[model samples]
Target: MATVAGVAVEGGHWIGGERVSSPTTFDDVSPIDEKVIAEISRGGEREARAAVEAAGKAFPSWSRTSREERARLLHAIADGVEKRLDQLAIVETTDNGALLRSHLRGVMPRVAHNFRFFADWLLTLGHEDFETRGHRNHVSWDPAGVCALITPWNAPLMLATWKIAPALAAGNTVVLKPAEWTPLTASLLADITAQAGLPDGVFNVVQGYGAEAGAALVADPGVRRVSFTGSVPTARHISTAAAANLTPLSLELGGKSPLLVFADSDLDLAVDLAVEQYDNAGQVCLSAVRLLVEESVAEEFTARFVAKASALNQGDPRDLATDIGPQIHRRQFERIDGFVQRARAEGATALIGGGPNTDLGGLYYRPTLFTGVAAGSEIVNEEVFGPVLTLQTFRTEEQAVEMANSTRFGLAATLATGSEERAARVSERLVAGTVWVNCFFVRDLKAPFGGSRQSGVGREGGDWSFDFYCDLKNTVTAPWEK
Candidate 1:
């Protein structure tokens, strides 16, 4: 078995529309193949604070921009993103493990689509006003000053855009911080914004570890809103930091999301949709990691799922044919491998793979699935955040829901059933933020996306995102002329 390894490097930062250097530098590597990709920098506290201050300075003008004008800028950003699809995809894949072709060709198109969708929504939203009493009181949309955006490296730019597009369209200035593991895409986004001719200080990026740049941004008193996507522990830390300032926050945290596959579902379609659960090598926060299948179909489903998972090509993320890729870094690879090891010690049986590919030489792990995980085991209750899925059986819908909500996390769930009414009942009752009926990761930018419990607070996407970034203030006019 070869060990997969890569360098851990600094990819710099972008603040006030300027590509700035990180105060400290590190090496970045691929977890699958152990390749050196870039020299990353540890962002400075001074820089992070400066970025937030810049965003605060820009917020007034940005918040006051006409809805039509904001939409135009967002639409222009979409156009620029469209033009750089390949480059963005390549940069995204290099910084993260997402497949180049799929992300560039598949995921990015969706991000662009999301951009246009929100841009149009921007125009539709700011025009509406809620007036109460004879004194005309109009509620107008405005930006949350100095929104602090923190992104993980898993999907890099795709997830970043999910926040950036809407925040910009909603007329908020932003200071973004990319995960230390993958700062390349965020660094490049500075150029992307430049191409879009975004105003100075409207958007910024800072690069460093969560403890440094990220922690500083969240705690900055000048920052009025904070949006973060990462692990549960990190979310908790950010929550604590934000609480000090009563800063409005949005956290799209980790999940041990469930997939309830009833016996009535088509096996073929179920298997196909199951792919998304493990796509990106099972790194997605909203991904379904705890699979609950009816015992009757468990045998068949497990067999096929194991074969497909074990057979996936694990290689360069730039390769379209490669289905699975390396882990993000050395520490993460060890963490995932350690989790699988602990699961085995706790008596869970690996039906397919639960080990690293010693052939890769550093950070790669096999896309693995575990069966026989006891209800109380780590595999059953924890967010693995790797290419590992733990599955168990249930005899009834009620049992499935109970098992689904068994974990402390509740980010999203996928209910696979033939009955629309049954799916609805389960969907309504599931403890997750987003429920997929007979599918997984089926998202529309117009919908609210977040969690129900320990998963997160508030929501992202649609007009709700606008609400998270801004508080509505009522303006009163004494029965005046129109």
Candidate 2:
């Protein structure tokens, strides 16, 4: 497997069914080393205008197509993604520090399933109203024209497809700007999309920074909506831009999610679930930042949790033996380390694996677990985009819920309890978009995933995602049959 730091790519921008070299360009470096893996084209203001015009042109015809017809197109896309699974996977692995064999396999299946899932969903959405039993009330769905989908670096391809696939299924033309850090996979997605015979300008990718091409795309008057997944600060900026045009927007922002362990919860099950929540070195937006444990099991849980976290081998993401890898960059590495240092100075215990892994050449951080994390510390409050979990003990279930809801982010929360009632209770009290009971990160294509508060507005995935990317138009006949 080619390491992300070493993979060589012939960089260019994919626009309107063609890989065109841009006048403007930027270098994409692997976070592992400062080596320039590829010098990708950075779309300028002209390119952004062209992309918006193309997307706008495609929207009219694409939007009016029947849902069944749209579903067929999506199915073809899914098939195309499957056929080029190996190629796409390798590209994805090289672009992002995802495991080659494991990450590739999971994502291909996911990409394939995404198309089929959305296709099935699109098929079920009809123009006729089922709710109006005797009356002649009809419903219609129109594509939000020229949607500018700005996706993040962490899960670029998957997150882009999360919007692109559904937006396409619902007949919205897309001008996608992939994150500067991970551009290859999304660029390859443009290839597969073209291969699927998706209409020209219906799907497009422009690789550039958030401040340049990304801002241009977001602020484009031609774009009717903007869907973004990244930092909260970025989302706020996008929201401001979108508001200027009064364009609809879907924002999936940051998360400092929590996992509450009730006294009745099985410690073994909780530990098992914790591994995944903090996986990818806890770079996940849904990474359980706070581990809220009841006083009874706090010490016991900490021992097991520390042991499991410490045992994880941090190395190159390409290695199958590696459970975790370095952060995306040295900057992120320093930021995470700084947070750990501040916590320790604030009198918090570095329970285990609190520092860097000296053995790794890349920017590797240990899976840190911090105890005595007071609410005031940086580690306790801020989103440390690394493998760090702040432990907080609660004497009662109510206290657990209180601390869990303390964060401004309400993206996702988990409750591990023996009794179904306790699980339901905590799940209800916890203010989050998704509450996992017993299971963690059990994401099905059918489940809606997103946040409630500062985590950002709206949901993605499931049937609701179809609605998110499109607009609704309802027609009424005054109790008269058509």
RMSD list, candidates in order: 3.6, 2.4
Question: What digit string (tens of lDDT, one per residue) describes model 1 on residues 1-482?
Answer: 11112322225567776657755677666544557677776786899888987888788888888888878878888888798777777666776777877886678887677678888987777544555666666787666678889988888878888988888887788888887777776666677677887888999988787898899999999988889988778988999999999998898888888888899988767766676677887888888888899989989987777766667787778778888777788788888999999989988888877898777656678877888889978878888789888889999888988899888888888878888889888988889888888767778888999987888888887779888877767677787676
- Count clashing residue pairs per candidate: 36, 0
Model 1, residue 35: C-alpha shift (Å)? 3.1
| Model 1 residue 426 CA deviation in Å | 1.6
Candidate 2 ranges with C-alpha deviation above 4 Å: 1-10, 127-135, 478-482
lDDT value for model 2: 0.80
**Per-model C-alpha lDDT, please?**
0.80, 0.80
TM-score for model 2? 0.95
Q: Give each model a TM-score.
A: 0.93, 0.95
- Model 1, position 433, has a per-residue lDDT of 89
Off by over 4 Å in 1: 1-11, 126-133
Evaluate model 1: give its TM-score.
Answer: 0.93
